[model samples]
Target: MDTGFNWVKPMLLMIALAAIPSVSLGAGLPDRIALDSLKNLYDSVQFNHAGHIRLLKDCAGCHHHTTGNLVEDANCVRCHQNSSETKVVACRGCHAAQPFSAEAQRKKQAEMKLYHQDKPGLKGAYHLNCMGCHQKMGGPTGCKDCHPMNKTGEALYNTGSFAPKKTGKAAKEH
Candidate 1:
């Protein structure tokens, strides 16, 4: 009745449990994301995270590091992992602020350009990721669509703007 097989069941069960991916890991998804880490030259991009989640199939659509399943917080070590603590890297941490001197600014710009040749600056990264996805999904692809200008022609924030534009024949019919 007991031929050392008792341990095998428990061992197999443990393995199976370990193999099962965590359904609820990492930080909970936010309804909205105000990207104001960097100084707001333009309006802090008001990201509708909840809406995006509904429209997209997977969390990985926005969180590139994620792989369909919910990502464990421990695994987010690629960007800002310290031995003592884990932290999200701020844009300014890498992308230095605009220099005051013209020559210094030019040099800094060149350096940033080279450093982010593949990765790109904060604005560039946002444009490539957000705008690219919007374009692919047949959404708005205009400056005013994301960053609406004020009556005086300055970028405005939280003014009930930044809605996706309706277009095409079907949109016209409506």
Candidate 2:
């Protein structure tokens, strides 16, 4: 019962190759943060690093092979990028209906607003973690990098069937 076209090896190899270059090339930002430091901070939910990197002349500085907004290694982002659901963490879930604001917070079914007081705000955490590093590395940053006022667009993920790995799970692709 062997088709013999196993694809796991190639998939793992590509992941490894992509991970090798995600280090801090020079632009300066640490690649990790504690979970307690990540609650309610990402309102729009796209993890603004990619947008921030676009403004920099050197892409590698923030986009090293093993860090910042890509699936690589043991980075905090690698697994959590999808949040609890299979959504893009925010890209498809929230849909921006309007920009995230504290006003929306007070009306957010109570549980959501007070849910993560122990965690640092996204902006605050990013600042405390990388502000100093960027200063040392001569990097550019400002309020806009973290909280741009206007944002739009769909993430446009390819439609595909996917599932978690577990023993004895059986299904068919239509």
lDDT of 2 by residue, 1-174 (tens): 245657777889889767743544433342332322222332242444533544454432433322334433356456445533232332213223322477655555465655333333444444654576567767556644543332121112111122234323443431
Backbone clashes in model 2: 9
TM-score of 2: 0.24
Which model scores highest in lDDT? 1
The segments of candidate 2 whose C-alpha lies over 4 angstroms from its true place after superposition are 1-123, 151-174
Q: What is the clash count for each candidate, in the order shown?
A: 0, 9
Residue 15, candidate 2: C-alpha displacement in angstroms:
9.6
**Model 1 per-residue lDDT at 53:** 66
Q: List per-prediction Cα lDDT, in the order shown.
A: 0.57, 0.42
- Candidate 1, lDDT over the whole model: 0.57
**Mind sharing the TM-score for model 1?**
0.44
Error of 1 at 113 (Å): 16
- Write down the worst ten-residue block by lDDT for model 1: 80-89
